[model samples]
Target: MALDRWIALVFVTFCCAYGYLAFATMDQLLPPFMQRNPVWPSTFPKVLAILGVIVGLVVLFGLEKPDSQSEPSATDINYRRLHEYKLGQALMLLGLMALYALSLRPMGFLLSTTVFLMAGSAILGERRWVIMFAVSAVAAGSVWYLVQQVLGIFLRPLPFFLGG
Candidate 1:
């Protein structure tokens, strides 16, 4: 009758249904060639469903004890002391990600990744711009080279103006 028990019951039901559907529709969802593989495409979903069922059973049975010391009291709740810097940094990082995604194809992987790393380091309070840029360049170039040359995975080419 407790909230945790109710949540667990719902979670178990959903996971069971999801697992059943995933297994039932595996053949239809996957290509014929893909179905030949030992690890089917539905494997991840089925695994997650099983894990979810286990977690739900644990929660429903109340296997874990609630820690009283970690619980916040009514008096301990203070809105004024909230850390703004952490929130601001998180928002900035998200914005940078969006910008990077938008510019990636046009700017190429190496250039976009370098800029993203430099911006992320600066936002995280790194002071030395020169060193940050150098590190960013090296890291980005290494990943690009490894993926393109060693792994044979081609990235988006640079724009025509930049000599793709």
Candidate 2:
């Protein structure tokens, strides 16, 4: 009846549903090479579902006792400051996400994701320009490389003009 149990049960149910979706939607036809391979497009997602189910079951059954040390300390801010929710910042981030989604095809994954990361960080109050640019570019490039090159997925990394 505890909150953690509820969360774990929800997690397990979600994982089961996810795994079913992967199985039900799997492609029926593939090139001869790919058809014979053990790793399909859904392999990773199904593996994630399995892992999630295991972790959720462990959490659901492993708890011995609730710890009282989770109580907030003196340095913690009071939760009554709902007026400082920074609604403007949240709205800006949402707008930025919408722009990123719209720009993905034209700007390509690498450029759009890098810009999104930098803009999101700036909107969240990161002041160091060089660090923001470097981190965003590296993270975006790394993900693009992994998804496109390593996983054999197609992702346009450059703008349309650049032959993405």
RMSD of each: 5.4, 5.5
Top model by lDDT, which number? 2
lDDT of 2 by residue, 20-78 (tens): 98777764555678977888998898899999999999877845435565764554344
Candidate lDDT (C-alpha), each: 0.85, 0.87
After superposition, the stretches of candidate 1 with alpha carbons farther than 4 Å from their true spots are 1-26, 31-37, 52-85
Model 1: lowest-lDDT 10 consecutive positions? 72-81
Residue 50 in model 1: lDDT:
93
Candidate 1 lDDT tens digits, 12-124: 99999999987787658787788789998788998999999999999888776456656545444244555733789989999999999998888999889999999999999
* lDDT (C-alpha) at residue 74 in model 2: 52
Query: Model 2: which residue pairs collide?
Result: none
